[model samples]
Target: MILETRGIGKRFGSVLALRDVSMGVRAGEVTCVLGDNGAGKSTLIKILAGVHQHDAGTLLVDGREVRLTGPRDALDRGIATVYQDLAMIPLMSVWRNFFLGSEPRKGLAFDVARARRVAREELKAMGIDIRDVDQPVGTLSGGERQSVAIARAVHFGARVLILDEPTSALGVKQAGVVLRYIARARDRGLGVVFITHNPHHAYPVGDRFLLLNRGAGMGEYGKADITPQELTSLMSGGAELEELAHELRRE
Candidate 1:
């Protein structure tokens, strides 16, 4: 396993955000974390991304216990998270956005040429083809922007990629494009943690599923262990859904 969380948990004042949520991601596999709103998915991602520390649990990198105090800590350990907002400046060029905080420098000066060359090469390595690295980030399509973010994370040497609701706002075609890049990332031998509520989106690319309900674990199952229909039904609260159907039945 590249990343492992043992009995991970978190709390906020009177509410319990997570409990005994254990998960693991290995190279060349996508672990999809599925849940609806307030299901503690965000909290769990924060923990894994080093945005928040687990109140209780063990975070292990390469099977060795480690503490993630902040985002830098996680990044140093080869973990990178791409949130829904993507963190790219609209007016900035693609290469600049790619190296925003960690820009390549030449003797205390920003190496604009080097950054552009490296960015183009890195994106090409991920099979992403954008017309120009000099174009402003806002000029790229939504799917393209998402792909750039993924490529940036991969280029930065992130052994584990944590994506939060990456496909939520995209159209079917755009979502399909992003999913392709996700598969590409997995193929590159990186552990991928894909978080989303859409069963359709998760089903196609996920190797393992960790279902969350009201801040608790429903269960973890391999792709071969459960059907997509079963996963969707369970995610929608099967018994509760049955009750709801009966309640809404016309006489």
Candidate 2:
């Protein structure tokens, strides 16, 4: 396993954000974290990404206990997170944004030629097609932007890619595009932690499903053990969904 949490818990003042959450992400597999708003999904990912420290339980990286000091610490350990907003400059060129902070250096200056070539080659290697590397990132579609972010993460030696709601703002076709890239990433042997509220999106590409409600785990299930319908019900709170369904039924 690349990343695992055992009985992890976190609290903010009087509120408990997460409690007894346990999950593992393995190489070449997609571990999908499913939950609605305020389900402790964000808190969990933040802990994984090294943005927040867990107040309780153990966090293991490659079977070794480790405490992350910050995001840089997480990156040093090969855990990179691509958030929903993507953290890319919209007006910058695609290649520039790809190598935003970690540009190759030639002498005392940034190596523009090397950066552009490497960026283009990496994107193509990941099956991402871009007509021009000079085009502004804002010009690309949402899925394309997400693809770029994923490609960037892979190129930077990320062993565990934690994607935060990548398809949340995308349309059907655009979301499909991102999902294909996610599958490609998984096939290439990187452990992926896919966070999403939509079970439909997660069900297609996920190997394992972890459902959360309020601030605790509903359960974790393998693909063979849970159908898409069942996963959806679990994410929405099965009883709550049943009550809503009954309310909508005619008298």
Candidate 3:
């Protein structure tokens, strides 16, 4: 396993954000985290990404118990998170954004030629067909931006990629584009933690599913053990969807 949490719990003063949440992420596989708002999905990934520390239970990376101090600490440990916002500068060129913080340098000067070549090569390698690397990031489509972020993470040596609600804001076609890139990443042997509220988006690409509700776990199931319909029902808290179905039925 690339990453695992056992009985993990978190608290925010009087509120408990997560309790007894356990899941594992493996290399070359996608672990879909399904949840509604306030379901502790964000909290759980925050802990995994080192933005927050768990107050209870254990977090293991490569089979060793370790406390993550902050985001950089997590990155240093080969765990990288690509949040929905993506953290890319809108005005920057693709190559510049690709190596924003860790830019390659030649004797105290940025290696412009090398950076450009690498950025272009990496995107092409991932089957992303961007017209120009010189284009400003803000001009790219939402799906294109996401593809760039995923490629950046992979290029920077991320072993486990935690993506927070990656497909939430995209249209159907754009979402499909991002999903293909995710499959490409998994194919390249990166463990992908895909967090989203959409079961339709999760069901197609997920190898395993972990459902979260009200800051607690519903259960974890492999794709073979759970159907898409079952996953949607559980994610919506079962009764709520049934209630909606009854209310919407024709007279």
Q: What are the RMSD figures for all models against the true structure?
A: 1.9, 2.1, 2.6
lDDT of 3 by residue, 1-251 (tens): 98999999999999999999999999999999999999999999899999999999999999999989999999998899999999999999988999999999999999999999999999999999999999998999999999999999999999999999999999999999999999999999999999999999999999999999999998999999999989987877687867878889954
Error of model 3, residue 137, in angstroms: 0.6
The lDDT of each candidate is 0.94, 0.95, 0.95
The true-versus-predicted C-alpha distance at residue 109 of model 3, in Å, is 1.0
What is candidate 1's lDDT per residue for 1-251, written digit by digit as tens?
A: 99998888998888899998988999999999999999999999999988888888888999999878999999999999999999999899999999999989899999988999999999999999999999999999999999999999999999999999999999999999999999999999999999999999999999999999888888899999999999899888886988888989953
lDDT of 2: 0.95
Candidate 2 lDDT by residue in tens digits, 1-251: 99999988999999999999999999999999999999999999999999999999999999999999999999999999999999999999999999999989999999999999999999999999998999999999999999999999999999999999999999999999999999999999999999999999999999998888888987789999999888877776788867888988954
Preferred candidate (lDDT higher): 1 or 3: 3
Q: Candidate 3: lDDT of 240?
A: 84
Reference-based TM-score, model 2: 0.96
TM-score of each prediction: 0.95, 0.96, 0.95
The superposed Cα distance between candidate 1 and the true structure at residue 142, in angstroms, equals 1.1
After TM-score superposition, the amount by which residue 17's alpha carbon in candidate 1 deviates from its true location, in angstroms, is 0.8
